[model samples]
Target chain A: MTSPSVPAAPTLTPALGRKLHPWPVRIMHWTNAMAMIVLIGSGWGIYDDSVIFHFIYFPQWARIGSWAAESLLWHFAAMWVLAINGFVYLTYGVFTGRLRERMLPIRISDVIHTVQDTLRFKIAHEDLTVYNAVQKLLYIVVIFAGISQVITGIAVWKPIQFSGLAEVLGGFQGARLLHFLGMAVITGFLIVHVALSLLVPSTLWAMLAGGPRLKTPKLEAAE
Target chain B: MRSPNRPATPPDAAILDNHRAEIRMLERRGILRGTLSLGSLAMLTGCDISDDTSIGKALRAMSSFNDFVQAKIFDPNHLAPEYPASMVLKPPRFNAYYEIEKIRPIDGPNWTLAVSGLVNDKQAWTREKIATLPQREMIIRHICVEGWDYIGQWSGVPLRTFLEAVGADLNAKYVSFQTADDYPSSIDMATALHPQTLLATKYAGETLADPFGYPLRLRTSTKLGFKNPKWITAIEVSNTYMPGYWEKLGFNWQSGI
Candidate 1:
């Protein structure tokens, strides 16, 4: 909510828009993007190195580095970057009240309605600042999925010392399976996320350059 | 029942069937599948997955928790599943840091296993004397960290028998092993005393081939292949943790599957 004394869009212009993402958010966003790419690519190679399911195998092209050892190095290195960057982003979000404002206040009804709206193709691209119920749900899920990947990653990486964590995940073999499954979930989310971004090009613009270009509609006057 | 004219299933096929049944058993026990879904994970770990630092810390802490749980649940008496002799892989895969051709042959006649550290018997064990110890044979799959696995028949004195004969301090925390090839490794005492843990002398019913760590090797199904050190030269039991070659390079010390 904007204060009464301050203008709504400080840098709004006919051709451009105000900054929606702060510098920290933008920096962390790109860093996270890079980390995810490295993680998924290297993760595939690691998965192929080990046999989990008897019948299923990752395609060769999906694998990252040439060798298992090399892929593992990339996976570990990217993991650290992802973890630290995620930590900073989360800390900033919580302390700045951004997480609460954006992702919270979700209701079961909102989720159900959003799913129905999505299925019927009736959803509107109304407000860039305000996340739709479906967007909120997905963002939350993806965040959690990232965390799960890290946890399962550690369990598989160091099963002996982390035997308890691995055991909770089922065991060494089970942890490997869960790790692969987590990767699959994240990959699925990435696909849907990219498609949605393409559908809403303004959202992509906001992510890359802070905010979307548009005229303030009557919704702001109502607020 | 099969007709007399029908051919019997190949030995390797039987082994594969046994492996499949074992996997099914694990699945049934909730060890391989269906137990660690996202919902269950959320419940088991109280922190929300979106809470990065808390979840990371919690998961790291859980590693130790896992170690504790595994240590408690480990059954020293429980044996790794064994296969029939016909299932043994021909020319069991040679795996080592060095190439097979570069492996320096240990002179079998003069070779002796040195015993040291927290043991009453400090005398070296000659191959002949080691052979006289009560022997055991097992056909177990050697799972490698690199992911391939092979079933092989290993014949040796039970490590427990050797430890007891050496008057080892059974309460020691760790058992360190040093190989003639300069590769060092260790295992927890509980694992050292496991019935399946072997001071292997032979492979495929004959004396261990040079490439397979002739004279002696450590063999156990509980651990990954790297944990089973070959060309073993010395044994030391101590309270302090001594990391192995791969373990020093970030591999888990307790590499049990």
Candidate 2:
């Protein structure tokens, strides 16, 4: 791979893609991302609704404070949206076979070397096209994180029905702790995702426009 | 140029040659449409397999463990404070489940409690025998784990008197309560003899309903709603501790609401 990276005069040029993201994948992916953000924000609101947080309490509008019944309802509603959207997206990805293409990490040594080179800043920005191993791992972890939120959240919501579950996790209190921790992890990951998007402008377009663009020579070598 | 087996199926050779560039472009950029499709598909395999592989075992362990821990926490000798009727939460909420099926029989002088276990004496006490011994009354909140609270007045004979009657063995660490409903619960011997704990029959001036453990019930303010067992039938001092149904299932065995 380094042999090809010898700073050779341009031999390959990028061609614009006619097909970007498949419509379903694009829709579901973006929606899932948005839904998670809303859910996380609303979850924070609900958690703080009951407690008087540092120097501040939730405004009266934020909660009826009529024994927290309203906050509880909001939590349940947001949870349903996040769960349903995630389920549909996951199902479609499997049935349609798009998951295979997007999720499989680049197995070739060349891609690994390319990632190392990019990390070292040895490779020019042009040489980067394939997502590095780190990206693949983050994406996968987020998917599982969403799952954790749902499972732990259920353990909190209906400790009796899911009592058996509550028992294993050390009961309702334990489940609540896990649920809060899961949200925190997701929030941290989102911060990193946004930073990366800024680092590489193409990331935004790639998701929005469907296919990422490789500056010409890399595209040529790739072809 | 296709082989006979391929016979008219679009030849891989031709398609490969034609689409190789497009495929390369898609692959190189990682802008492929199927990223989530692949990830989600893999996750699908993980989804249906209920995560609680050892849920049953954990439940059992926890129930027993909770009882053991709660026993260790409170010295049954020191009782929870019983407040006057003024301290009761007004409009007491009826939460969880409360019911009564059997009442004290008319001319009811003979509700008896059996004490058996690692004790020197195994005996049964008639209601008349218990009432004659010692009586205590106080009001306290029944804090439900489900987040409801209610305070009710209770009057009952002390469990210590029963333990003293049976002469519980010094080594006995646990006390098990067998309710008339066939629902048996156990707590630490210390919890059993808690000062505020009682084998009580009267609730708010009337005999407890069968659902409320009619003849007698155990009440401890330190623990959550469920710890208070109703319908006292048999009290056994034991060497080992274990959890009841709810505790085994996943609730905090201590369950101090």
Candidate 3:
């Protein structure tokens, strides 16, 4: 056999010729993130103000008084922004098939590979793809959660106008409970996502700057 | 487990190519969903944008601001249009809670208006005392925030007339209404004393039903259905205002009809 081919040297460089994120995707991503943060924060305010949960005793210093009406107004207004933005983004994703490519797993293998890569920390910084497996799963989950919130919100908004939907959800009380639960889930996920971002600084930078510097590994030259 | 600190291998050209292909597909799907949803939201926006739609404007204006966002959709100054006597309907199903379990007569002798707290005088008066006062009648539509509406004729003394006699104390901020059924609610004294508000004793020209505040009820035409507390009982005047039953349970307190 001919002498073994020499291995190419590893290099550290800015991701050259790599496509930057599309404007719509970038804009929507940041907007959704910011809106969700505001919504979850204001939602906590509302929960604190709720009379039903006011039975719990807290020190005067630790306790926050209920401002139900004010909290409701905050929630309602922010809801329109969050809802409209999500509707636009989701619609765009579906029609453009971007949702299927970026947000949805292409196949079982891709999903499996993603999971394995995440578990093994085998994801490459230089990967041209925008999201890794964990990110993809989270994006999908958030979209579904947003849809659930809209459905449950309407059920509570006009119980009579959407009587059938309300009935399906077991009336106003049930709808209210579901809406509360949805908020809690979203809030929980947000906390986890922030934590992960801190753990993976590069991933956070990718979202912020639309790309990151990646170090390519050395490879053996073919004989 | 592989250490994340270790550099990850770059995905091969084939994988990148596959991702590019998938991204293209997703892009197309995303565009379709975006257009469809945008169109739907546009339609929704259009419905609420017209300036002449009082309720829609109120909802939208209030949506953006911290204020109550009242457009004065219903004018309290104007008397609620009277309905023909024949248009009045009786309770097909009596809607009383406490009296449903037990029948109780609310007569002039048994009924007393407890005018106290934040008032110049704290005293109880017989229903006869109320009946002897100047009476006014109006046919008004009771609109529930839940969206049902019904027209009923009310005959009673005006709450403002009573407040005038008692001389409301300067510190009085709200009037808390407690009915015989134990159903309770509160309203700003200003709202309680509004011209359309009546301490009603008659409906459809007949004596009140036990289920319908037999001797008297606080009938405020300017408010949603629940604000018009039924049944005659104690009235406490207070210096601070708070939410009522449904209001505490997520319903609007002012609950303008």
Winning candidate number (TM-score): 1
Task: Tell how far residue A161 is off in model 2, in angstroms.
Answer: 28
Native interface contact recovery, model 1:
0.10
Docking quality tier of candidate 1? incorrect
Give the poorly placed runs of model 2, Cα more than 4 Å off: A1-223, B1-82, B87-110, B209-211
lDDT of each: 0.76, 0.59, 0.61
Model 1 chain A worst lDDT run, 10 consecutive residues: A8-17
lDDT of 3 by residue, B208-240 (tens): 877677787888876656787777587777887
lDDT score, candidate 3, position A113: 81
TM-score of 3: 0.46
**Colliding residue pairs in candidate 1:** A163-B66, A164-B66, A164-B67, A165-B66
Sort by TM-score, best first.
Answer: 1, 3, 2
For all candidates, state DockQ relative to the true structure.
0.05, 0.02, 0.04
Ordered from best to worst DockQ, the candidate numbers read 1, 3, 2
Model 1, residue B81: distance off in Å is 16
All candidates in order of lDDT, best leading: 1, 3, 2
Candidate with top DockQ is 1
